[model samples]
Target: MELRQLHYFVKVAKKEHVTQAAEELHVAQSAVSRQIHQLEEELGVKLFVQKGRNLQLTPVGQLFLKRVEVILADLERSVIEIHEFLDPEKGEIRLGFPHSLGISLIPQVVAAFRKQHPNVKFRFKQGMYPTLIRDMIKGDIDLAFISPFPDEHEFVCGEVLLTEELYAILPPGHRFSEEESIKLRELEDETFVLFSEGYSLRPIVWEACQEAGFTPKIGFEGEETDTIRGLVAAGMGVSLLPEMALHYTGPLQPAKVRVTEPQVTRTIGLIRRTNEKLPLVAKVFHAFLLRYFQERIQESQ
Candidate 1:
């Protein structure tokens, strides 16, 4: 009939004596008996047989006891999970990262986070800023590592994690490949291999070229970084990529030269849905990214 009734029933079933069950439960014997009786009436089953003050569980009572034990165990586990999720030291956190950041910054932060909170698990998805924002709005992602200046007011964004400088990946024999750094104007006549429109770098690279007083002459477009690199390595065309792409150890081999004209940089940040209650894990990750990026900024200085 109620939680108390179920507790009394379980206690009596365990001890097989109303007096002992009541004492163990810190309740009076008559109260336990009355509650058990009420539970029996509610369930339309006689849960106990009495013989000279000795209580014995009936067949139905034994079957029901198993189910009740399972339910109580689940309730206890649910409470524990809720508390650990709030504590940040345990439970699961789902976060998103842009493709480049996922390869560079995120792994370092995740390693540090895991060292401190081994019980916590992370589910990471790779996406561009727009897709990341969409997932955050749908509550499919808790937070995201986003590129420079997320413009939408519908989400909260933290300080920059790192600044990604654009670079031109030149084939082995290009004239400026040996230069320290090349200006965007140097690529005005060069064919450009670029990623698809959804990639965060696409807009930045395009804008950087426009700032140099010319539009990009796109020769090839692909989704995967590896594919784009392959195209460049085969001498299909030169491409503008984030500094992080130089770290790629894939088959593509291209000379990386920094972009000096207008000196473009994309500041990355942690983004979350505005006005939503963030879980403790997400909050911890957000703080971690800010600290990590600040240290990087200091080191570069």
Candidate 2:
């Protein structure tokens, strides 16, 4: 039976009067009656009977009413869920970022976005660049803050949010600690604390060292930038890190020396799946981040 017929049947079942049901449904009485009759014919069951001046439901009619209620309720709920999904102001966003940005940038941006769109919720995934890119491609994350941008064609990159210079973090009493700016080649002989494989910064630093004429002599390997910084502070080795790493180094701040000869830096931007359009919430957040960074750039200038 058609949904219209089921709707008419439900109204009639609820009111127990065709005239009142039609009036409430804003349809003609004969139209409502015809729909109910068609539904009963299709089901091969009588749905109503006369009880003096009023109409009453038959036994089968009561059973059908219960099932119809559930079906109609589920349909209504589905419509509401679709509307919420399309709503820009009310939805969830799955966001991904590297552990370095997670220390400050991600939290600040999320807080600012929530201040205006309080109904929007966020699911955060913190990982290195490779992991974030992998998750984005797999549809596990909606959007991410990624550095140096993804080279694959499966992802689309947005405008640069931030460009941070790479610094050589040295121990407190190291020879290079007193220099105003150090060249990458100068650290060729020194032990280095490098990020583990799969981290985006490792390649950027490695390439810079290669251009400077020698590969870095790696002393230790760690995942998070903060841990690498800690290693530097403990005299384990020197490391190349983005400026953002310095902000969260706490009391054990390593000596930060700007890399000059080939001045290395990393550009961070938003990235998402190229195949699918972003959800309304993710689109809004993407725009919000672009605008936020643009304003920061203007203020800095």
Candidate 3:
């Protein structure tokens, strides 16, 4: 049977009335009936039987209906994917990022790429590091921006785009705030404002504090980088934060001092499924991101 025949069968099965199905399919009722008749003849089965004014699928017809729907749906997806492959600038990208990059890095990259391919679209998913990686593996997101970039696993791979030094965020009038750069050990006595445990930044800060010979005394725990910064700026405590997270916090930003001794840093990078054959728009953004940071790093150097 032809593809149209299968399409007509599914429509007729759902609608249960030949006239209504024909009208919805924009075809004459006689044509729909003829196609349905031909499909039944080819398979040597009475696929539908009339009951009063409506049609109902026979036992085998009900089974065929389920498989035919799947086939048609898969065909439609293939058609759309090829269309995107032919003109990728008009395609869409499903992307993932952590909260840290949302305000600073993500917008800058997407805005720059869209200026060149205005028809390209983006759908973003924001979560913690492991969650984003799981999204890539499950194909929920074609790519992700992860910091302290992960090592490649059997299913996922990452590429470091840029490495930025982690800085200590101290209260504005705190003694260390006036110093140009200070050692991590110097803040051993201070209460620390930090991201909660699940956040990637939380472990980074903890590890640095551990290496510095002190376990940070907790003052307040928060999820958003802005919340952590705001608390510290209000003289609640101190914390370590990545450079990107520092850029977009507004006037309430705490005083930032570079960490000198036992200097720490985070690598902001992209992650994708190891086997993913990314859609054209996603590949375009991926390349743009890598080049964007490379150029920025070179300029700074």
Question: Which one is best on lDDT?
Answer: 3
lDDT for each residue of candidate 3 in 219-280, tens digit (9 for 90 to 100): 89999988998899889999988887788546776999999778988888888878657776
lDDT of 2 at 206: 92
Candidate 3 lowest-lDDT run of ten: 72-81
lDDT of 3 at 136: 71
Q: Whose TM-score is greatest here? A: 3
Candidate 2 lands at a TM-score of 0.70
**What TM-score goes with each of the models?**
0.69, 0.70, 0.73
Query: Each prediction's Cα RMSD?
Result: 15.3, 16.0, 9.4
Residue 48 of model 3 has an lDDT of 92
The C-alpha local distance difference test score for the whole of candidate 1 amounts to 0.79
For model 2, the superposed segments whose C-alpha errors exceed 4 Å read 1-87
Clash-forming residue pairs, model 1 = none
lDDT of 3 at 289: 84
